[model samples]
Every structure is written in C-alpha cells, then in structure tokens.
Target: MTIYILLLLIAMQLIGVYFFQNLEDRFYENFRDNLEKQAGILQEVIKDKMTPGTESEKQRKAIDDILNKLPLDKKNTIQIVDQESVVIATTSGENSRIGQKNKSPRVSRVLQGIESPSVEVSHKAGNRYMVYSYPIKNDGDIIGAVYIEAPMQEMYDTIRTVSKILIKITAAAMVGTSLLGIILARTITNPVKEITEQATVMAEGDFNRKVTVKSDDEIGKLASAFNHLAQHLRDALSQNEEEKGRLQSVLANMSDGVIATDRKGKVIVSNRRARKMLGKDIELNEDINQVLPLANPISFPLTEERESFLELNRDEDETLILKLTFTPVLRASREAVGLILVLQDVTEEEKLDRQRKEFVANVSHELRTPLTTIKSYLEALDEGGAMEEPELASRFLRVTRQEAERMTRLIHDLLQLSKLDSEKVRFHKQPLRLEELLEDAADRFSFQCRQKDIAFSLSIRKPLPRVYADRDQIDRVLDNLLSNAVKYTPEGQSVSLSAHRRSDGYVEVVVSDKGIGIPKKDLDRIFERFYRVDKARSRSMGGTGLGLAIAREIVQAHGGTIRMDSRYGEGTTVRFTLPPCEPEVNPA
Candidate 1:
C-alpha cells in the first residue's frame, strides 16, 4: 500500500510542476505583447501632431496628451527619440529629451533603420524594464523612435501566485492518491495476511485450521485450495494416529520381545517383553549396546532379498534361546529409515521339538530290545523240539514273560509322559500331613534303598504344618525325590528326609542325599523333561527322565516352589515349599 501511494504522489507532483511552468510562460508572453501595443499607439499620436523639423507647443501638448492617454503608469516608462538617437520627449516626469541620447543600443539601431522593431532591456530610475522600440516614419523616412519600459514585477507576482496554487494542488492530490492506494492494497493484502497465518499453523502440524475465501480473485482461490488441503491433511493425520495406536497395542501384547532401532543403531522403541528380556533398568533412548552387548555383534539382513536370523542365548543356566530377526522400514522414496528387531523366545518350542525326536528314538530302542529278546526265546523253543524237554520250555516261557513286563514298564512311562505333556491329568486336592506323606514315600522306596545298602532316615519337627495339596500328586512328588536320592547315593551312604515349618508360614520338605552331587551348571535345569546330569547312569537305573518334570508340575499346581542346592563331589539337597493349610474350625 505504501509503495502504491508513493508512486501516485510522485506522478501528481510531476504533472503539477509541468502545468505551472506552462501557465507562467503564457502569462508573461501575453502581458508583454499587450504592453508593447499600447506603447506603439501613443508613439503614433505624438508623431502626427509634430510639425516638420521643429518642436512646436502644439506638438508638445500633443505629446503630453498622448502620454496621458497612454496606459503608462509609474510601473511603466515611455521615452521618444529622433533619428539622431536624441531624446525628443519622455513620460518619466521629465522634459529633458531635447538633447539626451537614447542609451539603449537596440533603440539606437532601430532609429538608424538597420534593426527591426523589437523589445530590449532599458535601465532607468534604478529598475529594470522590458522596452519595446518602434519607429515613427513619414513617407518611409525614419523620423522618430518610441521605446516603452514595463517592469517585470507583475509577471513575477503572477508566477508566484500560480506556483503557490500548484504546490497546494500537488500536495492535496498526493494525499488523496495515497489514501486510495492504501484502501485498494488493503483489500488484497488483508486476505493474504490471514492465509499466511493459517499456513503457519499448518506448518506447525495443526491441519484443522482453514483459510476464509471471500472473493473469486487469485488470492481467494489460493485460500480455497489451502483450506481443502488442510482438511485432507487432517484426515490423513488422524488415520496415521490410529494406525500408530494399533501398532503400539500389538507390540504391547505380543509374546515375543520386540526392539526397534533407527539407522544409527540407537534404540527407538521397545515392547514390554523386550524390556523384560533386556532388564527393566533400561529405558527408551538408551543405546542397544548397553542392553544387549553380546547380541550387538549379531546383525540381521533387512533388504528385500535378504533375511537373516541370529540365535541368541538368553539364559546360560537353562539354554533359553531367542531367534532375532530384522526387517527394514522404508519411506515412500524407498529409503531405509530404520530396522525392526523381533525377538522370538524359542526356548520352550525348541525343547519340545527335541524331546519329541528323542522320545521316538528312545521308544524304538526300548521296544526293539524287548521284542528281540522275546523273538529269540520263542525261536529257540520252536526249533529245539522243546515238547521233549518240558523244563527248558518253562524256562523259555519265564524269560519271555520277563521281556513282556519290561515292554509294559517302558510303555507305561511313555504314556505317563504323554499325558503330562498334553495337560490331561487331573489332581484331587486335600489337606495332608507332610510328615505322614514323607514317611509313606520313604517306606515305598525302602526296597531299593536296601538293595543299594543306603541307610534312610526321617526327621520330622514336632507340630509340622499340614499342607494343602493333591494327596496323590504329593505322594508321587515325595516318591520321585526319595527314589532319586537313594539311587544316586553310594552304598552305606545316608539319605535323610526332613519336614519343618518355614518362616513365611509354609511347610518345607527337604530331601538331602550323600551322593555324587550335581555340578552347579546343571542344577538349574534338572527339572526339565528328559534332562539328565548323567545320561548313562540314569538310563541304567530305569530312569525315564520325566520323574522330576512331573514333580515340578504337580508342585506348581499346588502353589509351591521347588529348588535344588548342589555342589560337585559334595552333596545335594532338594527343597520344596508348600503353603500350609488353615486348620478347620469347629462350629462356634
């Protein structure tokens, strides 16, 4: 607006200056021409009244009368000169023209008839004047010259008045033009300002702001387009937020651990499972190196044609395994921005898969041995004409029966393990005295202990707390622990069972053995199905490797915990805790 106003002001000033100069020039030209004409008429009258060659009183009166009739005032002076350049008469309140020569060279030249009648400058009475010279001729002979002087003050005064009017008009016109320019500019710029503010809001991520379009001009069209764009942006941003929320929900509830990192390998986000795996002390924005230093060297392929996995050991004690996979997240430009690290805890899955394979192989081996023995015995009986030797037949039959019993035992253990794996076993819960249960389990294992020549003892603290458990499951649990102790202990070694009250109001039953103890490294995983510290010795003793596993499950179902403390070449203690049952109250 200011620029437009400035341009209008400049243009008006230029036009005003041009008009005032032209007006001044025309005023001066017309004023000078009229003055010269009046002076010429006065000169003709004086020449007509004059007698030839002599000055007469009549001519003098005629000159004075002509001068009086002339429009000469104090601002104008008139003088008459002869052909000799001598002053003949004057209108400056003087009669000294009889001998005075015309000092103006222009007037002298005119009297000599060598110059045209013209206007020139004359100096008189201490003022400058415009003088017009004319010749009075008789019969084409130059007789006298007329000179008129008009002061330039009136022209100067007229020009000054016109100049003042022009200045005032120029200023008024400039002000009016500036105001009009500001109004017009505002009409355009005000809407643009509003659009600019709305654009700023949009840049700051507030897509809901819209610009108002009030006209069909270019600026209005721009505003309309901007509003439409903002609406679309708002919808897209809302959808993006909802998608992000769904992604977060999936990550939160996923069983597998997930960690996401930027291109710089800095941690960007982590799910609950990932945080737990990395330890709760870590937080977002922490370096991945700090959380998984060992796994940092394991890289995953994220390209379209590449897929790689890193097998990570999460627990050294239990051989817990995680499969880490990486996938790339790309922008619309197909630039890789970051990576997604997916951690699948495959410990249980992998263990179960290995167990299935081992079970098939072990079942084949166990059945093969028994079937081979029975087949050999039956073949011997069939080939030897054994009806002539009844004693040999009976022995062969007894051996066949023993082989069949072995097969039955192997099948039973396999079925029990299968039932446990499928969670098909149901337990009946009841309160049982811990000491009595321990005693019964020990008595069932006395025969094995006697064969091994291992002494067994039981220590029951007085007033031992009764435990809430499934009676049959507790019996199996106690039998498993006692039989394991007796089998592992050397001959003449003592295996002891103790029951006592724990500080946390639970009952603790500890079965300790003087045996070739387990190594510290294998203690934590002793309860895993089919895990054996000494595979050869355990199998030689008819161990199915599922006893401790079943015991663990039963204890957990009864709201109890089992743990082992062992030292190599020293001794081992297996302690289990069961919550005490509240005493039944009589009717009060």
Candidate 2:
C-alpha cells in the first residue's frame, strides 16, 4: 500500500508539473501573439496618417482614435514615433508617455526601416512590457515607426492563481491516495499476516489457532485452505500418536520379548520386556546383533527363520534357554524392509520336559526290576523239579509277593505325584494341635525305631500353636519324615521330634536324627521324586524314593515351607512350618 501511494504521488507530481508548465507556456505565447497582431493593425491604419504632411499632434490623435475604435483595453499602451526615434502619440494613461523621445532599441530599429518587437522592463512605471515596433511606410519609404508596450502583470497574476489551484489539487490527491492505501492494507495485508503466523505456529506443532476470515476474497480463501490443511495434519498426527501408544502397550504387556529393527539392523523399537530380557544397557538405534542372544548372527535381508535355542547363563544358580523367532517385516511389495525378532524364555519349559522324560524312565525302571524278579521266580517254579518241592515253592512265592508289593508301592507313589502335578488333589483342612500330631507320629514310628535299636524322643514346647491342615495329608507327611529318620539311623542312635511356636506366627515341627547324613551336593536334590543319595540301600529297604517329594507337595499345599539342614557324617535336621490357625477356629 505504501509503495502504491508513493508511486501515485510521484506520477501526480510529474503530470501536474508538466500540465502547469505547458499551460503557462501556452498562455504567454497567446498573449504575445495577440499583442503583436494588435500592434500591426494599429501600424497599418496610422501609416498614411503619420506620413510627411501630417502634424505630430494630429497623428497622435488619429492613432488614439484608431486604437479606441479597435476595442483595445486600457491596460495596453501604443505609441507612434517619427524617424528620429521620438514619441509622437501615446495611449498609456492619457498622454503619460506623449511627446517623449522613445529611446528603446526596438523603436530606433523600426525608424531605420527595420521592424522588431522585444520585451523590456520600464523603470518609470516599474512594470514589465512586451514592446513591438512597426515602420510606417508610404510607397516603400519609411516615414514613422509605431512603438507598442503591453504590461504582463495580469498574466503573472493569472499564473499565480492557477499554480495555487494546482498545488491544492495535488495535495488533495496525495491525501486520498494515502487513505486508500490504508484501506487496502487492512483488506489484504492483515489476513496474509494472520495466515503466515498460523503457518509458523503449525510448523511448531500447534494447530489449534485459526486465522480470522473477514472477507470472501482471494486472501480469505487462501486462509480457509490453510486451515483445512492444518486440520488434516493435526488429525494425521493424532492418529500416529494413538497407533504408537497402542504398539507400545502391546509390546510392554507381551510375554515374549519383542525387538524391531530397521533395514540397517539398528534397533528402532524395543519394549520394556525386551529391555528386561536383553539388559538395561539396550538402547534405541543400537546394533541388534550386539544385544540379542541368538545362536547365529542376524543378517540383512532377513527371512522367516527360527534360530536354535540359545543358552544365557546369568549365574550358576540361574540359566536361561531362549528361543528366538525372526520374522521379516515386509512392505506391500513383498520387499523386506526390516526385521522383528521375538525372544521366548523357555528355560522352565525345557526343565519340565526333561523332568517328564526322567520320571517316565524312572517309573519304567522301577516297575521292570520287580517284574523281572517275579518273572524269573515264576519261570523257575514252572520247571518240574522246583514245583515238586513245597518248601522251595513257598520260598519262591514269598519272594514274589514281596516284589509285587514293591511294584504296588511304586505305582501308588507315581499316581500321587501325577495328582500333585495336575493339582487334582483337594485337602480337607481343619484346626489341629501340633503337639498331639507330633506325639501320634512318634508313636507310629516307635516299633520301627525299636527294630533298628535306635532311641526315639519327642519334645513339645508348652502352649504350642495349633495349625490348620488336612489331617490325612499331615499324617502322611509325618509318617514319611519319621520312617526315613528311623531307617537311616544306626543302632543305638537317637532321633527326636520337636514342636514349637515360632516368632513369625507359624508352628514349626522339626525331626532331627543322628544318622549318616546326606552329602552337601545331594542335599539340594533330596526332595526330588525318585532321587536318593544312596539308591542301592534305599531300594533294598523297600523305599519308593517318592516319600520326600510327596511330603513337600503336601506341606506346600497347606501353605507351608519345608527345608533340610544336614552335615555329612554328622546328623540331619528337617524342619517345616505351617501357618497357625486363626483365633476364631476351635482346636480339633
């Protein structure tokens, strides 16, 4: 707008100067032309009158009469001068310049028969004049000259008035142009400025501000389009954020660790589980091969390949077996652009599978030994001589009965273990006095201790806490512990059962025996099914090797914990704790 106003101002100024200058030039040219024509007409009419015979006063009078008849204004002056450059007649202000020698160069030249007109300033009248001289000739002989003077004050006054009007017009034009410039600026510049500001804000990720549209012009339409584009951009950004949030949620809650990499094999996305499984040092843009535990290195142009199980040994106590599944992320063109690697920790599953195999093998081995013995004895009795001797046959049948009983015990233990594993066994729980249960178990194991010639004792702390447990299961647990203690104790060794209330609100029952204790290495596996430190001695003594495992399961089902503390060649102490009964439950 300002530029427009400045351009208009300059144009107006140039045009105004040109028009005024031309008008002044034309005005002066027409004034001079009219003055010269009038002077010529006066010279022609008075030329015969100003010839040699006429008196100077009559000639002047004749010129005045002619000028009066020619409609000349009072501001004009005409003079007739003779051959001597002397003024004869004057019409300026009634004989003001009469009988005066006109010494002007123009008049002298006309008297010499050369006519010329020139401009000069009159010192007497203090005015500028356009002087014209004309030679009065009679029959080609110069007789007198005519001198004319026209004052230019009126043209000067008219030029001054026109100049003032032109200045006023130019000023008025400039003022109006400035006002229009301001209006145009408001109409156009303001909206463009608002749109630019909104665009800047949108660049900085804020799309909530809108431009105000005041008109339905081009600028307003542009602003509307900008607003629409901003809305679409804002929606697109919102959807991207929501998708990112859902992806993060899925990755965080997934059981398997997930890691996503770009085509360059740099990690792009990793979740909490992935970081935990890998390590805290795992970071975005890190090389996937460096952090991931894979049996083989990852390659570009990844394929849908499952790597072999990789072992991650954190410590001696904890080892992890992870299965890595690599899946290539493909675009719609079926081009592999990245990779998604999933890590599944299958350590516990692998351990369970191995245990299942071992359990099956052990069950078969346990059943086969007895079945083989019974088969061998039956075959011998089937021979003719063996069946004919009654004593020998009775001996063989007794051995066969013992072997069958061992098989039955093995099968029963295996079934119980299976029930525990599947959580199919339900406990019928009730409140019971810990001291009475200890005494009952000690009495049941008394005969076994006597047969081994080992002394058994029971110690009960007074006011022992009662426990809530299934009576039959608790009895079996007690029987397993006592039988083991009696069977392992040497003759003349001592075994003790004690019950007490512990500080952590549990009833602690301990069975300690001065027997050949377990080795430190075998202590950890003592509670495992079919695991025996002395396998040969245990099998010979009619042990199924599942007693301790069953005991642990029953104790855990009652919400208790069991542990063993044994020193090689010293003694063994097995202790278990059960939660005390609530105050509301009456003791059984």
Best by lDDT: 2
Q: Which pairs of residues have clashing backbones in candidate 2?
A: none
Any runs in candidate 2 off by more than 4 Å, and if so which? 1-172, 207-256, 303-308, 377-398, 421-437, 463-472, 503-506, 578-588
Q: What is the clash count for each candidate, in the order shown?
A: 1, 0
lDDT at position 382, candidate 2? 96
- lDDT for each residue of candidate 2 in 541-564, tens digit (9 for 90 to 100): 889789999999989988999999
- Candidate no. 1 TM-score: 0.68
TM-score quality measure for candidate 2: 0.68
What value does the lDDT take at residue 517 in candidate 2? 93
Write out the backbone clash pairs for model 1: 87-97
Q: Estimate each model's TM-score.
A: 0.68, 0.68
Q: lDDT score, residue 550, model 2?
A: 96
Q: 432-534, model 1: which lDDT tens digit per residue? A: 7877787787787776788889888888886777777888888888888888898788898888888988767778899999898999889877987667898
- Superposed Cα RMSD, model 2: 6.9
